[model samples]
Target: MGGESNRSLSLLHESQNKINSSKDVFLEKCL
Candidate 1:
């Protein structure tokens, strides 16, 4: 159970980083 939770947490963090990078690219294009 603990390992499963850690895996999901890492996945969530990875997705969050992708979202943040995409947002940065979008802002750059808007400017």
Candidate 2:
């Protein structure tokens, strides 16, 4: 159970990072 939770948390963090990077790119283009 602990391992499963850790995997899920890592996946979520990765997705969030991707989203933030994309947002940064979009804002840079707008500038």
Candidate 3:
């Protein structure tokens, strides 16, 4: 159960990073 939670956390972190980077790029373009 702990291992499964850890994997989920990492996947979430990765997806968050991807979303943040994409947002940064979009804001840069807008500016």
Candidate 4:
């Protein structure tokens, strides 16, 4: 159970990073 939750957390973190990077790209284009 602990291992499964850890994997989920990492996956969420990766997705969060992807979202942040995409937002940055969008902001650059808006400028």
Candidate 5:
């Protein structure tokens, strides 16, 4: 159970990073 929770956390973090990077790209285009 502990291992599964850790895996889920990492996946969430990865997705969060992807969202942030996409936001940055959108901002650059707006400029």
Candidate 6:
């Protein structure tokens, strides 16, 4: 019942979160 889609969605969400975290770290270092 759409388990594969859910898995991919979660993976994408995690990757987006990682990108956001890295961006935040870079901004903090720049400040």
TM-score of each: 0.93, 0.94, 0.87, 0.91, 0.93, 0.92
lDDT of 1: 1.00
Q: Name the runs in model 4 displaced over 4 angstroms.
A: none
Model 6 Cα lDDT, one tens digit per residue, 1-31: 5999999999999999999999999999999
Q: Cα deviation of 3 in candidate 4 (Å)? A: 0.7
Q: Against the hidden true structure, what lDDT does model 4 obtain?
A: 1.00
Model 3 lowest lDDT segment of ten: 1-10
**Better structure of 2 and 6 per lDDT:** 2
Please identify model 3 stretches exceeding 4 Å from their true place: none
lDDT of each: 1.00, 1.00, 1.00, 1.00, 1.00, 0.98
What are the RMSD figures for all models against the true structure? 0.4, 0.3, 0.5, 0.4, 0.4, 1.0
The candidate 6 region of ten consecutive residues with least summed lDDT is 1-10
Question: Which scores better on TM-score, 4 or 6?
Answer: 6
In model 3, how many backbone clashes occur?
0
Which residue pairs show backbone clashes in model 5? none
